[model samples]
Target: RAFARSEVWDLLESCHLRCNPLGDAGVAELARGRQRRFLRHLDIAHSDVTDDGLTELSKSDRFPGLQSLEVGYGYSVRSPNAGPAFGPDGIAALLTTEQWALKRLHVSVVSDTPLAGRFEELRSRFADRLTIQQIGTDPHR
Candidate 1:
């Protein structure tokens, strides 16, 4: 279910590509959209995205109007092996970008990993503007 760059130009402001197999290429294309400035919420969770994909998304001024993001839902009950596709470096790349306006960032971190430590650090850095949360099981409950 990949969207053509031109096709999403108008109503892609709040995209939800979760578990749709949009891989890194799709994510990159979306991030590089001509209408990116109009994008507000982007959810790429449980897809085939990678660290480089996230890096591409973090490129200069890519998502200026983005507010909420949800990127790793591998742990969701739907697919245990689904993701955590992009790692801490990927997340760090986005956080380090300038003029970030994210209000919420939802991700999944394996309980015992260096990524968890990094997430704590990221949470502290964006505490004022971002609310990072680990998506829990029982999403419908």
Candidate 2:
């Protein structure tokens, strides 16, 4: 609320909302206001965002400078259903859009799930700009 009304939004270039409990509604709210003009990077990992939210974000033409977006459930002991609701459909929404200026996208999904395999297929389609990885575990670790 305060953020949407603040004048400081004009100066913000990168926003990291990781670990916040903001759901689809929050994403809608954040997508509003004038900050989109300057926001370049957005990280919503572990924020409970969903496909509907991603679609809404993609449909908006407000963000012309948004270059990077990170949406995933990072390392945690969450229940099978507790991670982010991201999937291939959401990725398609983001990629097919001509509204945003997205250049790089990173998504995390659970291993062995149908979503992971779908994402793999999507990865090859947008290999230059998209990166998909398994959630709760990192190959580097």
Candidate 3:
């Protein structure tokens, strides 16, 4: 609920935004930014974002200056709606976007999901600029 307000998006001077349990609605608001030019670090871990949200974030115009993206698990408590926030396809989509300035990505891959198998590929695709880290468990399949 912390990152749901449009006022937060209006603060263009802010460089870092961190929140958990935000779900898709909060992410949608964040991704809907038309003037958030200064946002650099975005941490929305332990939320309910899916591939759609990830796709929006990967857009060339969205978060053009964003340097770090932290998603997936970071909390001890899990939501009933929680699931694989994004997978290899999401990462691949992000990599294809030419306008992103991302340097680091923090993720939590559920140990049992197919995404776990794609970590190496993600690393290879991003080379040394993008760092993806697993932070917790995988909820949905």
Candidate 4:
């Protein structure tokens, strides 16, 4: 992939692939690319990256300096269904990992899912560093 041999990999600081629909396979490729030591921000909202992709990203040692990550659609007035492909399990995997130096994260989830129950706990753990938006309709409603 281009990212793997990019000459600017060491100098690149931010990457925004919003709405690209790269999915899990694409994310895996990006994760396996050459180390991005200076990269700080990554926005993959609406890229179709699922929990498996998030897990791979979190486990990669290439992004040691990464500080901010935006994985989901938060308050975007785009397509109603165009949110993150991941859920509570993805977030848990990201936060539990010790590889990243993340200081900020943004994500969106449906209100009716099990993520709602763990939202408070996750918020408490990360405090203001984590921003989560509950989007979509509540299935019960």
Candidate 5:
């Protein structure tokens, strides 16, 4: 279930579902379609999506009217055995997208890692528009 169903998410406007270990294929396609037609707020925390899946979702400026994307501690899917892998630097893609009207991107992953570097780049491009971009490590931040 790599894709989201437009029909299911269609009925539920304000979707608040826990991230499944198998990934939320339930709304993958609906998440990809013209967002204005269905969604307004989406809260995804502790999902099984790594930078790979996030990058896939942001293939284009597809999600319009989406104001927030809360990915809290959800980027732990990378292979720890690997030398370095922090969510595939998908922030760059998200920040650069023309249609990402994101306001709250809550990622609890520590900063100054690979993800931070990508965030810096994204900040440069979208300094004014970007808000609540909480980067950097936090013992409980």
Candidate 6:
């Protein structure tokens, strides 16, 4: 809910936006030009964003300047086949030149159900540049 765009707000050179219950506000702000310039690194840890929200955000061309992105994880309400994954499908919209500037990404998720497939997709898209750290109680097939 803190999406204000002003010179005062622009002074934020380095910011680490983390929220356990990060809503659409940050996503909406990023979609806008609020954090367009000064925000080089962003951390959206502990955010409960679903595939739908991630898909919407990935489609945006605003984060071209982003150098690093860190996505945290929690429980999800994903389907069985897809198994609540947040892999390449979610990030597919960003794998192009629009997100080519990203030097690194750090994701911590419990990839069970279909989440593993999503994770695998991400590894494929990112090629050797991806490092995944999956921690879940479910077995991996």
- Model 1 accuracy (lDDT, Cα): 0.67
Per-residue error (Å), model 2, residue 88 = 1.0
lDDT computed for candidate 4: 0.74
Runs in model 3 with CA error above 4 Å? Answer: 1-19, 74-83, 101-103, 110-115, 135-141
Clashes of 4: 0
- Model 5 residue 99 CA deviation (Å) reads 2.5
Per-residue alpha-carbon lDDT of candidate 5 for residues 71-108, written as tens digits (9 for 90 to 100): 53423436543332235265555555556645445454
RMSD of each: 4.3, 3.1, 4.9, 4.3, 4.8, 4.3
Weakest lDDT window of 10 consecutive positions for candidate 6 = 77-86
lDDT of all the models against the reference? 0.67, 0.74, 0.60, 0.74, 0.50, 0.58
lDDT (tens digit, per residue) of candidate 1 on 1-141: 245456545656887878787787887777765556777887887777788987887774656778978777355455565546676787777767764544466665432223457767877887765455554455464
Query: Which residue pairs of candidate 4 clash?
Result: none
Candidate 3 displacement at residue 137 in angstroms: 7.3
Residue 57, model 6: Cα distance from true site in angstroms: 2.4
User: Positional deviation of 1 in candidate 2, in angstroms?
Assistant: 3.1
Give the distance in Å from residue 46's predicted Cα in candidate 1 to where it truly belongs: 1.6
Q: What is the lDDT of candidate 5?
A: 0.50
Q: What is the lDDT of residue 77 in candidate 2?
A: 62
Total backbone collisions for each predicted model: 0, 0, 2, 0, 3, 4
* Number of the candidate with higher lDDT, 1 or 3: 1
Candidate 3 lDDT, tens digit per residue, 53-123? 76676763656666777766433344444455566776666666776544466665444434466767777
TM-score of each: 0.71, 0.81, 0.68, 0.77, 0.58, 0.67
